[model samples]
Target chain A: MLAVDMAGETVRAMNGSMVAYDGEMTFKRQGMTGGEGLRGALRRRVAGESMTLMEVTGQGTVYFASEATEVTLVELAGDTLLVESDSLLALDGRLQTGVQFIGLRGMGTGQGLATTKVEGQGTVAILSDGPAIALEVAPGTPLCVDPHAYVAHRGQLQQDVVTDVNWRTVLGQGSGESVQFRYQGHGLVYVQPAERGGILEI
Target chain B: MTSTTFNAATLPANDNVNPYAFSVDLNGQWFTQKGKMIAYYGQIRFQALSAGPLDMLVAESFHSPLYAHDWIVAEGQGKLLLADRGFDINSYDLDKGNLTIRAANLLAFEPGLELKQSIIPGFLTLIGTGRFVAASNGPVHFVEPPIRVDPQALLGWADCPSPCHHYDHGYVRGVLGAARMMFGVGGTSGEEHQFDFTGEGTVLIQSSEHVTSSDAMLRELEGQIGMLGVPGLRQLHGTIAQRLAAEQQH
Candidate 1:
């Protein structure tokens, strides 16, 4: 659970995520486009990265939690954070949310063809099935991760879907580690310890 | 609580990042169960146990032919992270000692250790001096022998002889009890049987009684099914159908 001290400032949070609060507060459901006007709404609908955010303004403190999952707070300054829509919990109202094409990495994970990109300066809280580990990606040090365990990533990193097909896989005795997402360049990748089963195999 | 961000330089070398994750300082090779790897930094290559290049290494360290398909060899240099379904993960170090763990609970181990299939149907034994990681439904409790543990809660035992099945025959010896056992009419307490261990070694049990799905058990049973003749196979099918019908009625 995350508690935030509010002083009349508004924050964007996942709809129906508020668990408890003290003092006076008001929550207003965000529009279909996430307050990005008609054009942004159209893009979100087209890209299938739909997010239902609510504007919360209050005086004392407000608590937010979803499904008792662990929450990680990330501070961003003029950088882009690419996260799954279902994993996003809450973020500063000043941050911009948009859809970005993420290629075929989402093919097997059932997360759609695009991911939610959060940009600007503020703190964002993301949820994971378990505690998420942040791994560094640097020059000549590429990171390979299972698609079902990937949570989010930030910075200038190039990602490619790496498929390792061998004769055993063709013969119906495939090892379960055939597909992975390879990340290179400079960035940080967040992965949960457990895989989101049913969406992807291996 | 203030959260710390970790990079490749900051991540631990052959230790746990947290209770749910373990990081291996992979400079050489490690045997990891398939799909347990969450992420890794640096260069690491995962090959199936059946891969030809790993034949020599598999022959030397791994001895479980029944579960060869469920394991893979991770080779190269980097920090490899492993976890299992978000279960509580802990690393154990064995120094010239042997430890037998439930096959589902065993996650990954260094190449220095030799792995063999335990006498128990769903357990594996590790020998030599190296660190291996295992997952449990909750924090593991180590207790001395002369204890009876529910089979579902049994994680593994170290340096101990295999346990024997103990059943409460007194509770199921009469005519009514025999009828309940045969037709599944009356409900048993589900605790009529347990694994009784009595020795001078440590027996490990998880706090929670939840057992992970056992795919290896199915494979083992399939392997043994080949021993039956055509008539025996037909009889087995009839029994399975009757059991399924009973289960659905409940």
Candidate 2:
């Protein structure tokens, strides 16, 4: 659970994520066009990345929670965060949210063909099955992460699909770690300790 | 929890990042269960146990034919992170000892240990001096035997004789009890059955009675069906169909 103090400032949160509030607060459903406007809504609709958010404006502290999952707060400063729409919980109202096409790499990960891009300045709250671990991706040390456990990533990093598939995979005797996201450059990758079953799980 | 960032240099060598995840500093090889690896840094290569190059290593240490397809050998130098369905993961060291664990709970083990199928169904025994990782639904409790534990809560036992099924006395005490058991009419307290353990050694039990789903267990059951012959197989098929029909009704 996350408690956000509001002093007349607004925060956009996941729909129905508000568990309780101490003072007066009003939640207005984000309009037909998401917070990013019609362009983001159209891209999200096209890419199958849909997020339902509500604008919370009040004078007191509001608590947000979703299904008792653990929450991770990422403070972004003019950098972009690529996260799954389903994992997004809440974010500062000042941030801009959009959808970015992540190409074929997303297909093998079971995260779809696009991911929600959160940019601008403020904290973005993401949910994970367990506490998310942050791994630093530096110049020479590339990180390979199971797509199913991947939560979110930020910084100037290049994400590529690394495949170790061979005839063994075809014979149903392949290593389950055949598909992975190889992240390089400079950035931090957040991965949940638990894996969300993906296409490769079979 | 505050997010602490770990780089390849800082990731622990053969240790846990938290209660739910473990990190292995892989220099040579680690036998890992399929789909347990969450992430890793540095250079690493995952090969199927059936792969040709790993034939010698697997033949020496891995003896469980029933679980061959469910395992892979991660070979190379890197920091490997492993987790299982968000369960609490812990690494246990075997100093030239034997330990049997639920097949579904065993995540990965060092190549120094020899893994074989235990006599008990849905359990595997590791013999040798090495390290292995296992995940439990909750914190694992170690208790001495002369104890009866909920079957679902029993993780595994070390250096002890296998346990036997123990049913509550009330389950068969009277005519009313017998009738209720036969018809399945009355609601059960769900605490009548337990695993009775005795003799020396330690018994491991998870705090929760929730067992992870195991397709391997189903396969083990299927493998044992071969000895039943035609008549017994037919009877078992009929019984299973009836059970499936009953389940669908609910």
Candidate 3:
């Protein structure tokens, strides 16, 4: 499930039920435009998932800590780097966090994992298969993130909840709507093309 | 966890205390109704022998809504192998500064531990596992237990019934009052929304003021379970009558 589209960096199936993600990978997040029709374009979305397009950028590759136990995102931001972990041994992207209101259970019980944030910043690296998109999130804008597939964001204006949405009859409608991550600040949030969590690893 | 400056209120003005929870200076804003754009860093940790199928520690919030930052979530679940979507309850990017989110553990859709981007603004998340799907700003927005009683629908028990009002009690006094009086709760926010979920199944909720999390409110609400024991549980006469009179004064 871990794929890398970057040069030199590779996604290989290693010995034992593990995958080896070596080399550098390229990845980026796309935003939701053309409000009319938008279904998550990530190829690996689950059947009943509510995926949305993102307006952020990301890059990285997948690494294995041990067998199917976990996956790691090795990515870079400017001169900084990020290394994140995931529960799905099979996921490919420059990871981060976003709307998990629908996929909360997937990330729980370690079923699906993506990232962990520590205070401050550090040199983090990620591996993924992508054509990295570099977007600028200014002070008045912010982005929402999924913990699964993201790298990092600098800053943005934002709000913590999309707590209210009338039930929609659309694809990923009211069943479990996204809590709005309103971006009104001067920061960029990292997002992925796919909705990548919510399956039971076991 | 973010860095929090704690000047020991219990200790001394110059002293600092960093237990799990501590107070921060709000610049006169923390105690007021208006919210000042602020940043706070802190962590909540519990030493327990049990792990996995983990549960959130339900705690009463000490800071007023005005004093707390708009966003507060479990930045990380610590040094154990957390399940995908590592459990979370967060609220961030309070652009409107209107709503406070709460909930009893919502699951992550990203099954693998990876970073994710949200469609909503002013939000970003990190998953212990890349397993993520969707998350709520406040999982406790809805009544813990949806009032299924037919009479409420019939009696206009829901003041606004706009569906939005049902989520947060900050709006719609009649609806909020009815919900709290009926369920004996206003709502759950912060860590209070997290419950001891042994398995997978949604727990009902109700939002409110005095009682945010229903663990206590429900206990006090035990006074009404007897009504269910009687016939036509859906119909309320005496209990609703008395509680309504009491709530109006508050």
Candidate 4:
């Protein structure tokens, strides 16, 4: 559960994710574009990374939850966070949500070829099957993550899909660890303990 | 509550970073089950057990030919994180001792431990000194035996020499019991059968009774089918057909 204390400040959350509020509050569903204007709506439609958000303005504490999954709050200071639309829960109104192309890294998880990018300043809450572990990447140390477990990433990182195909894979005796996402640069990557069963068995 | 962000330097070395994930400070190599690795930092290389470079290590520590394909060797420097389908993961340390665990529950173990196939068809045994991680449906409880545990709840046993099938004799004695066994007409308590364990050792049981997928059991049956002659195979096919028909009706 996440509690947001507001003194008449506005926040945008996943539609219908508000569980309860202690103060005077009003929720208005942000239409097709998710408050990103007509261009964002069109982009979302084409990219297939649709996010339905609602504006919540209140004066007291409000609670938000989804599927009883654990929530992790990430505070951003102008850096961009690239996350799957399904994993995004809520974020402050100041953050701008946009779509970015992520290539085949998203193919394994059946999440399409793009991801939602959140920029600007404010706190964003993302959901995960379990608690999310944040791993740091630097020039000296690159990180390899299973695509199914990757939730979000921030900073100046370059990610590419690494496919390890050998003769065994041709014999139908492929090692399940055949595909991975290699992240290099300086940033933090968030991964959940559980893998989202998808096209990639691993 | 706010949780601390763990970076490469903050991640624990060979310890659980949380209840559901474990971080291995991999300076050398660790044998990890397939699909259990969530993320990792540093220069780690994952090679299948059959990979040429790992042939020598596989010969020394891994002995289960049936499951060799299901494991990989993770070698190099940095911290490697592993988890199994969001199940509760716990690490166990062995000091020249042996512990057998459900095949699906064993996630990753240090190369110092020798892994062998247990006598029990769906279980794996680890011997020698080292740390290994296993996942349970719920928190695991350790109980001393001379005890009978529901088959679904028995996770594994450590140093217990005897673990055999035990049936409630009273429920299977008379003519009625014989009829019930022959035909699926009567309803018997599902707990009528259990795994009985004895000797000096600890028995591990998950709080929840959920069992892992039955792929291991299916594989074991497939291996044994080779011993059956044509007539035996025909009978087995007939039995399976009957069972399938009954299931469809339900």
- For model 4, residues B1-250, the per-residue Cα lDDT tens digits are 4467777898998889999999999999999988888988887878878788888899999998888878888889988999987899999999999999999899999989999988788999999999999999989999999999997898999998859999898668898888877884577878888999989999999998898885777777787899999999999999999999999998
Candidate 2, superposed: residue stretches over 4 Å from native: A199-202, B241-250
Error of 2 at B1 (Å): 3.5
Task: Please provide, for model 1 over A1-202, each residue's C-alpha lDDT reduced to its tens digit, 9 standing for 90 to 100.
Answer: 8888999888999999999999899999997768878988898899888899999988999999999999999999999999998999999988999889887778878888999999999999999988888887888888888888999999999999988877777775666778889999999899998998746565
CAPRI category for model 4: medium
Task: Assess the local accuracy of residue A113 in candidate 3 as a C-alpha lDDT between 0 and 100.
Answer: 27
Best by lDDT: 2
Q: Which ten residues in a row have the lowest lDDT in candidate 4 chain A?
A: A169-178
Model 3's interface RMSD? 17.2
Cα lDDT tens digits for candidate 2, A167-193? 888888889888899999999999999
| Number of backbone-clashing residue pairs for each candidate, in the order shown | 0, 0, 170, 0
lDDT of each: 0.89, 0.92, 0.27, 0.89
* Tens-digit lDDT track of model 2 for B1-250: 5689999999888999988999999999999999999999888999888889998998999998899988999999989999998999999999999999999999999999999998888899999999999999989999998999998998999998988999989887788788878777676798989989999999999999898887888889989999999999999999999989999999
Q: Which is superior by lDDT, 3 or 4?
A: 4
Worst 10 residues of 4 chain B by lDDT: B1-10
Worst 10-residue lDDT window for candidate 2 chain A reads A193-202
The CAPRI-style docking tier of model 1 reads: medium
User: In model 4, what are the clashing residue pairs, if there are any?
Assistant: none
